[model samples]
Target: MNKGLFVMALEVSNLNKRNVYLMYLIIFLQGFVFYGPVAVIYRQRRGLAVSSIFIIESISWILMIILEIPWGYFADRFGYKKTLVISNILFFISKIVFYKAHSFNMFLLERILMAFSLSGISGCDIALLYSSINEKESEKVFGRYSALSNAGLFLASIISSILVKYSLDSTALLTSVFYGIASILTFFLTEVEVKNKNRINIKLCIDFVKSSKNIILLIFAVSLINEVVQAVAVFLYQIKLINCGFNIVYFGLLTAFLQLVRISSAKTHVLSSKFGQNKSLMIFFIIITLSCLAFLTLKNIPIIIIALALMCSSSAMISPIILDIENKSISIQDRATVLSIYAMCGDILSSAVNVVIGKVSDISIEASFTFCIIICFFALILLCLNFKGQFFNKYS
Candidate 1:
């Protein structure tokens, strides 16, 4: 890296750092708010059938898909900080609505707004971060960003669990408070001038699509497969524990432990740098496969706990590696848009899989895990082929 570039990378304006941190805080609040009432909502709401839940989630994802490209263009033209502030405001309002929501219809409305708000925030935050850091130092900065974000997630989950354990009704209110705080913090963030201030043309989008075809496909496929597998495993594991008379708190703790391990492992970049991106991803996929198999075979709580840890660690490993690969392939100008498209692919697949997993769980829990393993097997094969291609030539 050039000396000047190195200095520039480290010299992010105070405003940008503040903005990124605020986005991180909002993401933390988002997870906290969403997960806090999930199990309780399903358990207590008489009208909230599986189909209703799926519909709400599907609507959210559909909204995300519709908004992703336009919002990415908006951020590019208007500025990332402006987009962040707007998103935070929307999210704060959504949280309030969610707290006061009385019926499934109201919940769905709140969720759709929440999804749009979150989608706006997603790509813009990363684009701001990439703009602030030098291209050469982006990987290191992104790694740190991911680690800190995961730590925030772990803390939020712990806090949300405590809130839910004490009073389900209060959880939404508490989450809304956090969202408000995050929204307020956004006011302090500085705006980054987007490189291409002109309106995004179809030509740019098309060129980006053309340039990113292979890597985009890889990211999409891996993300879709991974989410499906993880969702199935989580659904089955939760049901199994509940049926076997395990405590809910224990499950929360198990989830917290998994996140903690993921946070810890994300800080270690040795494997990523040494083995190369594809190899590291391959290892993670293999670990996930083995973990899923272990979960299928093991009946012991302690052993299953270990399997969960492995599962999360493997899952955590995939995102950064894929992001790193994608980053290398696209220009900074279109990076966020490309990544959002990548995420949208996963969201679409996961939404569909959530419905299928819900039905499968009702029939046989083991069948879900078996299905996930099959998906993982397909993922592994695709990944292996990806590793053998020209894509690996540049990275490895």
Candidate 2:
């Protein structure tokens, strides 16, 4: 096999699976800690305007967008381990600040710090995982990583529900403690070497942008649509469940259940290779559209649960497929930066959509769901047009 082709092959043994698994565990714990407070922020701070909460989130995302590529480049040069350690320490500090925050401004400050820390860590972990594997197997390796991370998030959601029910402040403190643990565990991670130690030149960024324009555009569009759908679901589901007389605990449980379904569905790689990424994505989009439509009509707990599961599962399925395609198209050296750009686009769009959706929810929950359906439909059309050719060819 050609050297480049040989490196592209993804085998499980080639990766430091144990370290990846540990990273996944720490991330899962981090999610559980972070989200426990976030899941109830709107409810806890109900006195504050919903617009205020959205603005804070939007600001955080904007900060993340600005920081992502710089941090990715830093990782590419300094080593992934160093970046991970710094990110975890920053995360720990941010959690402390969040725990002590007494006002909205304080919270926003902590949020900004958190966003910066998260940006520093975002693509670096994936880059490390990719380095551990052969280049060809990057997609499959990333798929497994995605699945594990989702599973962590899912588990964290469940724990968050339990902690939030008892005491939000305590939950915040506990989450901070978990971050400390994650930071400690970071020391155990093995460092990966960058073959080229040259400073990240402007040309590399330009080259990545030029070469991966189509994939980048598709990723941005899909990410924005996905975020809108998610934001709407977040706002709509809360109101819908409340209207249906479900308690907060039950709502959290339902959310956790959906995450579990998503994590499980994400692990399966057969769809991407067998049906092809583009076709698989289209099918998943259809499922999401149907699920959202069902949500508009379904009121019963059982039916709503089923619909939410389908929506979550389908969304989760689409991510790995899209990411696999994205990973396949980029060179190893540019992978983190390219992925950071992709993430930045998604975060910016999602933040904007959240603000809009929050305002729309205040006016009418039904209208918000209607908006989501429209967005998903448009996304479906884009996927169809962009992916008309075989999955890999569209980007290649």
Candidate 3:
């Protein structure tokens, strides 16, 4: 009995390492069901106009923005495991709604549900992984997580493409099944112990902002750039491709190709090591801006694909790096709440921009791309401000 107990303790001590791999698996499942390849096309097939689709997506962003900080506070008070489980379950239910819905109102309902699910998961997942892993191994674990997630998307793009070829309803059904499995997987996750489970409110957020105002601003700026590009890519890029004279069959393949680019770019820390973090971040931001410019001007499929590859690569490269920065910038106890605040600011921007993009797209997809180019420049300006000395060094 003593020997068995000793061995059990030994295993529990090493659980963080195991959790890293488990997180990778969980993130991969999420990517698989993200349904990126067929999302926009599926809405169009369901008879939703592009403008209406954006309105629905905007509503999702609005809900997410509203709930993000509160959900994070709840996770901090209650526990990460329960919040994550609820997120998966809510997502599964949303997928079911999506599968059965033939009307825009039904899809709107699904988006609302999905927004709540996303709000719960956004900060909690990263906070859980950070709390579980050794601080030294964070960058490596995050890189692996991002890579595996993209690989899952790579597979999902193909699977969703094939399933969508059969029917949009079929794609939704399969996505729900994936989420169901993911929900079951959450039950197996080891919970991170929290010492302070007291209820925290908006003051916690205000304190964080006061301490790390610059970093928070920088994080929000980058997040806005990332979410806008992501929203457009997932929901409207297919339309851009269609305008470029590509067939629907190639959408999945193209999306799969972007995932590969993202996977390859996931190791931005390596770039940071080679060329200091500031310089490396600047380079990637410049790449993103240039890619947007290319998309603005280029009409050929090959050129557009190249531009998309650059955009995805930069977005993937910067995500974990920025999270690593934010993780270091704030207190561990307040991590999830602060991070949610960061994301909520971006979603607020996303909600507003989604409507504009949708409306502009009604006139011309090219004009929409032009709008994206302008947004990228705004992000670049913010990035430049942060790179100045002591700019993000307020609390750090």
TM-scores of the candidates in the order shown: 0.85, 0.86, 0.93
- Model 1's C-alpha root-mean-square deviation from the true structure amounts to 3.8
Better of 1 and 3 by TM-score: 3
Which ten-residue region of model 1 has the weakest summed lDDT?
34-43
| Root-mean-square deviation (CA) per prediction | 3.8, 4.4, 2.6
lDDT of 3: 0.79
TM-score of 3: 0.93
| Highest TM-score scorer | 3
Error of 1 at 135 (Å): 2.3
Model 2 poorest 10 in a row by lDDT:
34-43
Tell me the spans in candidate 3 whose CA falls farther than 4 Å from its real position. Answer: 1-9, 199-202, 389-396
Ranking by TM-score: 3, 2, 1
Question: What is the C-alpha lDDT profile of model 1 across 66-177, one tens digit per residue?
Answer: 7877777788778887888899899999888877777788888888889989889877777777776566666666665666656655666676567656765575777778
Which has the better TM-score: candidate 2, or candidate 3? 3
How would you encode candidate 2's per-residue C-alpha lDDT over 281-340 as one tens digit per residue?
778888778877777777886777687777777777776666667667666466677667
- Find the number of clashing residue pairs for candidate 3: 0
The clash count of every prediction, one per candidate, is: 0, 8, 0
